[model samples]
Target chain A: MGKPKKLLNNPVDVVTELIDGLTAACGGDLRRLDGRNAVVRTEIADGKVALLIGGGSGHEPMFPGFVGPNLADGAPCGEVFAAPTPDLILDTLSAVDRGRGVLMVYGNYAGDNMNFDIAAELAEEVGIVTRTVRVWDDVAAAPLDRITDRRGIAGDFFVIKVAGGAAAELSDLDEVYRVAVKARDNTRSMGVALAAGSIPETGERTFELPEDEIEIGMGAHGEPGIARRKITDADAIAEEMTDRILADLPFSAGDEVALLVNNLGATTCMEMLIVARKVHHVLKARGIAVHRTDVGSFLTCQEMAGLSITLMKLDGELKRYLDMPARSFAYSRA
Target chain B: MGKPKKLLNNPVDVVTELIDGLTAACGGDLRRLDGRNAVVRTEIADGKVALLIGGGSGHEPMFPGFVGPNLADGAPCGEVFAAPTPDLILDTLSAVDRGRGVLMVYGNYAGDNMNFDIAAELAEEVGIVTRTVRVWDDVAAAPLDRITDRRGIAGDFFVIKVAGGAAAELSDLDEVYRVAVKARDNTRSMGVALAAGSIPETGERTFELPEDEIEIGMGAHGEPGIARRKITDADAIAEEMTDRILADLPFSAGDEVALLVNNLGATTCMEMLIVARKVHHVLKARGIAVHRTDVGSFLTCQEMAGLSITLMKLDGELKRYLDMPARSFAYSRA
Candidate 1:
């Protein structure tokens, strides 16, 4: 296994160093919890349900950059490719929680489930209300009948955005959870990895891949996907991903959607724009309307070169929420 | 030389297809002039001096995606790693002119100079007033006496932003050009490249880089730089780049500025944030206050793995322009 050369100091300290760097660049919009691997919004708005989201770090803009107003109130960061512990989650929860209770959101993963579940129990013991919403939108992870068996991937962004927007619009915990469910249920995603993302700590690769080949449907963490094959045209890859996502959720003709051409890690924006061209053709041919499109590195593995295509079936409510004004170090809308 | 595998179709037509993809995904905010390799704002602001920027096309989000309100009025795209022809620039200038005149901006490349200079003469022949601003802020490219000999890299973003903001705020072409020149003069940048970005057309590497080594002060186009050595710690690399850039522009203590930690191409956001942390520390230790910091891929070279640090000294006017609200397919602020 070849480890991609990295510019890091003390591989074991990569995550801590990453957060320290992130908070400093953000000025005062973000802050770290004392002695904990977590971060919270510096100015928590009153009378709103706190939306908490987390997972393994490495997906830069996703887990931490998503912490701001109209987004996740706080995020408990885990080590690269590892989930946070219950205690870490509790720290962020306590710091961000106001009188409005809390809603926890994350992708479907074993470590994440166990840690978050334990933290929810801990929160209950402390008498703070908590609700959970797990994302299972990666159709390639499981059959339609076993949807919950699917692992969460980049589709978490759409769900989180809706959840954040809902939280900002209302104070009721159940209402926020309901819209979050709606967003998660309507979303679907699939990806193809042309290269593996390496972890700096172990100087190890997450998976092995042959040059001139690609793995279709690879997860964000480099987990097993549907198939691997010789490298082919980008249009074919985009078609494969779009067809799978559209069919699983049955996002058919006349349906409106917010399209996401997310770079898994190191795919260039130029390549992504090409992929978006094909995706647009695919959706247009089916009479679907693309309400909006986001093309950039939203979620990522560490320097993995590939991308994911996500479609969020949008309604009047979801569209309004998606268009709401939001700003962060990673993403913003004017 | 290793050709990093890419996801593109009909490599020769990549640029045209990229323009097609970008305009399509943008959902009507941007459009291409019929029968030309140029992109323009869907609705140009009337009576405003047109801001035109162009360069090679491989630097995604720079030449085309930057075309929108409060930014470049239009951008003529050249082939990958090549400059656009004067005819292409003429086509854009002809279409975007609104009586106020045109101001063209681009990196300090020889080919770009000839083409843009020719276009300026042609614009005069057609009775449309025109001015030009060439960016030369790469510290490693030249010594102080030969500052204009430096190649422009990610610093183009800051110059274009200030130019666009000025164009939107004032009706005078010379004033817009003056602010752009000031912005260009105040900015300084330096970068390090770990890997080379390959061209899809020939599947050939731009330059060779040994494993376990990096080239400090590398230009975005893989141009030769100051030194190449074994990979070192992030802090040391940041210090080398910061010291060179700060000294070149004399960004002394108590100076305020906007700092840009730009990814060259395939460098992940995780690596960039780590670099940002070190950069922030270096500036703080020198008593320099970072007014703002942007960490992401604002400009890139295919899939090159490395990054550049850009600092633009901000005066009251420059800061005002820097803070102006602008949104494009690739960048935005809420």
Candidate 2:
């Protein structure tokens, strides 16, 4: 295979250089705390709860882009698709703690869970308040009994949006964490990947699947998919992905939802909208009301050649918070 | 060549369907005029100057996205990569014609210019005041004396922003047109293409070059690039593109500029930012003061592997307006 063209001082220098560039782009609203691999917001409201979220580095604007006035205050940048160290997590907690407490939100993954668990233990020794809310929205990542054990995907949009709104309102750590968990519980997502991705450092394919085929339930990390099938029409692919997610989540007639049609990096906007229309058709046929809809690349997987459908079953409170104004590098609502 | 995926229903079906979707998405602020292809903001300020803009449809969040509170009052949607008809332009002018008159802003394309000129003539005959400003920002599209002869690329971003800010303050048509013209005069852009794009409808490639080569000074419509050379690092690409654009414009050492690093399409955020770093280095080496910077996938060529750099020579007033709060589908500042 031909090598991917990239520009860097050294193979190992990609992540650190990108982090510094991100800080500059954010115009001081974000900062990397010295002596640690953690990023913190410049403005921290005293007496108001704080939120710190993060994941692997390649998912730009995900955990990092979600940081701002009404969103996350810190995001510990991890290795490419790898979790951050426990010390880094503790450093982020220390930086964001305003005596009101902090909530740690991220996708459910083995490495992240263990590291964050250790960080929480460390915070407890200092009497710093800490809470963790695991987002498990990828219906294809696990079966029903293991739903709580599934990995997260673009549904983290809803999770961060709700959690940020709660944190901005001076809600305590427990309250913020509760709402975030509820948001994650009410959301379901499934993705299909049409192409494989290459890691910048190693120049190696993250995962291997035959060309001219697709994985219906590919995770962000190039994880093994749930099913394999021939590449097909856009509508067919949409139907398959949406069908499985709706069936898994059990949205009833008259149910209301907020749909997020997410692009996994390389998928075009034209493709994302096709996914959105299919989602609309599916929900409308079930007499489900789509309270609000965002059709864009809110979360991404670095040009993964696919899209994901995230449906957050909405309640009155969730809808209100969902409608709240937000601004980020990749998305904004005023 | 393999068959290209059908990203939308059909090429002919896309513009109308997208407009319909946008109407639903705009939530009461937008309405399509009766019996015409025009969209006007319902809350258009009475007795305030009206601003109108339009072009090909593929660049969503462009002409249409800029229509709102502090921007153009209306925009006419056209076929993908094709200009709207004279009738559409005339209808848009008529719908937005308040007592204060209207200004027409569009990229400098042959079909768009002729059609808009005809619309202006027709509107003038009907006793409605109208002024037109053609944006010509692509330095590589044509020579300096024939700048107006070149096509507009991403530099239209600065044009719309300044014009919109002027119109929002209820500036007269003449002032809005003047500021818009000034913005166009001061802006210059040049692009580089790594891969060719398809029209979606035809399922045919727009242009083709060898895999190991790149086309510098590329146009947005996949027109022939100024130079085709062997692909190299991002730094080398930036050097050639920046040198050509800066030489054509000839800026002074201490000049202040607002830079826009736009992804044509398909270029990942990581790649785009890499280009951005080089752009900054080039401008700084010339002792220029960079006022504000915007780097994102603003203008696109439907997954084409390319990027464009737009340098807007700015004064204090222009800088303030450019930095003012802007809320659009794809761009936002608060």
Whose TM-score is greatest here?
Answer: 1
Chain B alone vs. reference chain B, TM-score for every model = 0.98, 0.95
For candidate 2, state the interface root-mean-square deviation in angstroms to 1 decimal: 3.0
Docking class of 2: acceptable
Put down candidate 2 lDDT per residue, A199-311, tens digits, no spaces. 76776767766666789889987887799987776667877787887888787898888888777766655556555666677777878888777766666666566778888
- Quote the lDDT for A62 in model 1: 79
On the 0 to 100 scale, the lDDT of residue B131 in model 2 is 87
Q: TM-score for model 2?
A: 0.92
Tell me the whole-model lDDT of each prediction, alpha carbons only: 0.89, 0.77
* Stretch of 10 with least lDDT, candidate 2 chain A: A1-10
Q: List the residue pairs that clash in candidate 1.
A: none
Report residue A220 deviation for candidate 2 (angstroms): 2.0
In candidate 1, stretches whose alpha carbon ends up further than 4 angstroms from where it belongs are none
- For candidate 1, write residues A49-167 as lDDT tens digits: 99999999888887898888798899999998889999999888888888788999999999999999999999999987899999998899999999989999888999888898899
Candidate 1: tens digits of C-alpha lDDT, residues B116-226? 999999999999999999999899999989988999988999999999999999999999999999999999999899988887798788898888899998888889999
Instruction: Please name the candidate that would achieve the greatest DockQ relative to the true structure.
Output: 1
